[model samples]
Target: MKLTLTPSTIHPPFGRYAHGVKATGSGILVASGQLGIGPDGTVPADAEAQARICMDSIVAILREGGLTLGDVVRLNAFVTHHDYFAPYMAVRDEYLADLRQKPASTLVVAAGLSRPEFLVEIEATAVF
Candidate 1:
């Protein structure tokens, strides 16, 4: 079972996410950091495109574990530049829009990633 929490004492989450999640299940799925590489191994230069690809990759991986984004308890997003934040957030919101149980998420601007063309990388944890 999974419990999503949002205490009245604190301000509601700024975006599509929960304050926290409590899970009591045997399956704990941890996904590796996923880059924005496409099927042809091409990385898009634009932040929005890269963000979308990253989210798509995460969804595909979650399905392999018999879970969806709704089951994700946490997400860690890494971007190469701070300017990419808005675009990344937009894409993330689109992907998680329908999920009733959102995950706690953190976004950080990193100096670089494994590849220069990689604009964003997203990692996730899901319990189901």
Candidate 2:
């Protein structure tokens, strides 16, 4: 089982995530940051679509590791704009809503990413 923690010392988390997580399992999967590019190497213009693709990539990696989205203990998202948070979170919730253990998460608004067309990049850590 994984443990999610939110200490009283810190302010409450702003979104659907914990402040920390303690994972249990012998296997630990660390997924690289995944961009919005799809199989055809095309990125969508909308941040919501890009976020969905990024989550799909992350789920694929987790499956390859013999895990599921529920096994994720942490997620780090990099976005090009602060306004993208709502769209990104919408997609995130759509994907992660069924998870029994909510993961620790962080979203950073970067000045720019590797490619201008890429609106979001997401990375994850899981144990199972």
Candidate 3:
């Protein structure tokens, strides 16, 4: 089982995510950061579209480990600029909307990603 924690001592999360998640299980899966580039080597120009692709890639990685989004406990996301935060969060919220317990999440604006064309990158940790 997993528990989402938000201590009253601290300010509430600014987005649709928990401050922390406690998972008690035997296995833990950590997926590498996924870039916005598609399998065909195409990168979308829109930040929202790139964010969606990043989330989709993370979903596929979780599935490969025989787990679903429900098993995810944490997510770390990076964007090339502050302007991309809203678009990235929109996509993240959409994909995780159905989850009963939101995962712990962090989004950072970095100077750049591995690729110049990539706008967003996402990584996930799951417990099962």
Candidate 4:
């Protein structure tokens, strides 16, 4: 089972995410951070497109483990610049919209990623 936590004592999350998530299940799966590169080895120039690719990779990883987005308990995302924040969040929110209990999430603006062309990276932790 999973429980979303947003206690009245603290401010609500600014986005589509819970302040924390309490999960109890058989095991936890932590996916590595995924870059914006696609299977064709192409990286989109647009931040929103890159963000979508990152989220898609995360979804594929979760599905491989027999889990869905709803099973996700946490998310950590990194963007190359402050300008990319909104675009990244927009893509992320679209992916997580249907979940009953949103996962705890964090978004960071980094100086750069492994590759200069890469604009975003996303990782997830899921319980199953």
Clashing pairs in 3: none
TM-score of each: 0.78, 0.79, 0.79, 0.79
In model 3, which regions exceed 4 Å deviation? Answer: 1-26
**Candidate 4 local lDDT, 1-128, one digit each (tens):** 65554444322334576534445464776666777877767788999999887787667666655678998899999998999999999999999998889999999999998789989988888887
Summed backbone clashes in each candidate are: 0, 0, 0, 0
Across 10-108, the per-residue lDDT of candidate 3 in tens digits comes to 334345765344454657776667777666667889899988877877676666556788988999999998899999999999999999999999999
TM-score of candidate 4 against the unseen true structure:
0.79
Global Cα RMSD, each model? 11.5, 11.3, 11.5, 11.5
Candidate 2: where is the Cα deviation over 4 Å?
A: 1-26
Query: For model 2, how many clashes?
Result: 0
Clashes of 4: 0
Candidate 2: give the clashing pairs: none
Reference-based lDDT, residue 1, model 1? 74
For model 3, what is the alpha-carbon lDDT of residue 120? Answer: 91
lDDT of every model, 2 decimals: 0.76, 0.77, 0.77, 0.77
Clashing pairs in 4: none
